[model samples]
Target: MKKQNQKAWFFVLPVLLLVAFNALIPMMTVVNYSVQETFGNNLFFWEGLGWFEKLLRSERFHAALGRQFMFTGMILAIEVPLGVIIALSMPRSGFWVPVCLVLMALPMLIPWNVVGAMWNIFTLPDIGLLGYLMNHVLGIDYNMTQDPFAAWATIIVMDVWHWTSLVVLLSYAGLVSIPEAYYQAARIDGASNWSVFRHIQLPKMKQVLTIAILLRFMDSFNIYTEPFVLTGGGPGNATTLLSIDLVKIALGQFDLGPAAAMSLIYFVITLFVSWLFYTLMTKDDE
Candidate 1:
């Protein structure tokens, strides 16, 4: 047993080294930059806690953080249940299973920028199917460029379309992996559909649901490209998430110190929340 456990470490060692080189080194550099002020030509001055303090008090940061949380919460709430329902409705044993899975996976395979650009063209009010139907047929002002609510709605809908497939796939995997014996036993006991699902399917799916929730939360919280390409963080600052605002500060405004500090804070918050989610999701098992 000891030798087998020791052999497993060899498989993990390469990955650990790669992560250290690629992720940890860059992260430490960012931490260093976050604490120092730099002038042009490689001049740096100690400015410990200054940038962090400023970001903590900044109204823009507060607003962006609030919007980020709201978007992530809304996404998880909507996607999780919807994905589960879709998964449950899908055929359990059929030749169509592979076809359905491939179709579901298609969206997630597209490049992020392409997804954004495609949506941009597809939502044009003149030629776009959705835009024309919503604005003209429904008699609603649905232009994302001019209206804040419209912009928000478009972004949310686009995100749901893009990412709900991930949850669906994961849930479907969990559902399919459940042994037929469990269903047989449930049937023998005269279990109703709801009871079987509640007692067996839902519990078995907890791990995958936890993965879906964490992935969606982190992705939504850190979302930038789609919204940036779609709205450029605005028709005003209505869609400026924390990640977008951080990029704006770092590149657009050349505020490296503050942006670095904010990035560190962003990383910390994500890590903390993810750990909490893992704990909560796994606690019942113990």
Candidate 2:
């Protein structure tokens, strides 16, 4: 048997060290703050688990977390199916293939903050295009700044517009990689379009779909900038997701200890749910 080469380890060591330096240092700092209270001037008092206990009992935390779950769930429900459908409709070959791909990728290429700013301007009631059309032309009472439902709808639609492209691109990649033989066999068997999709295309796309679900789940769960810029967590706390709430506690209220504790809890919940998603999605492979 040939010996394993060890030289490649040296090449990767610097990157590993850099990652650890960045991640571990901040994590350790958070851990310290989580268990301690600060009264400024770098003075910290031992608080033990007080902050965590307080956070678990806070109604604000519960509401924010609930909103976060709602947002993520809605995002997944809308984007996943919509993306798959768009991907299936895309041209599989020739000149239109590149054109379709470039269009699909355009939304994702825009900066996150810019997307939020663009939507904010685009939805202004009197002057914005969508708002003017909805309120004036279509005669709909639509104002995100004054209405909770409108705010939520605007954010959800904004997110779908911004991110469904990711799911579409991933799904399209999976679709394109499927062997042409599968389609030919389905045709020979007189498979209906629905039957072809359900039986062959869906099964073949499982791996990429798993990836899409996980990525969307994590991103939506942790989303901050767009909603913050678009709604500022709403006309009220109607759209305040967990990340926004955490930032409010940390910076808005200057509550370092509770913020740190909440961050740790948020981190744990994300990890646990992600693990659950991975396990359920891949269980059949085992």
Task: Estimate, for each residue in 1-286, the C-alpha lDDT of model 1 and write its tens digit.
Answer: 4445468888999999999999999899899889999778988899999999989999999999998998898888888999999999989888999898998999999888888888887778878888888878887777888888988888888998999999999999999999999999999999999999999999999999999989988898889899999888888899998988999999998878888999999999999999999998999798
TM-scores for all predictions: 0.92, 0.95
Candidate 1 regions exceeding 4 Å error are 1-17
How good is model 1 by TM-score?
A: 0.92
Taking every candidate in turn, the Cα RMSD to the unseen true structure, in Å, is: 3.5, 2.8
Model 2, span 42-128: residue lDDT tens:
999999999999999999999999999999999999999999999999999999999999999999999999999999999999999
Predictions in order: lDDT? 0.90, 0.96
**Weakest ten-residue segment in model 1 by summed lDDT:** 1-10
- Steric overlap count per candidate: 0, 0
Q: Model 1's lDDT to the true fold?
A: 0.90
- Model 2, position 223, has a per-residue lDDT of 99
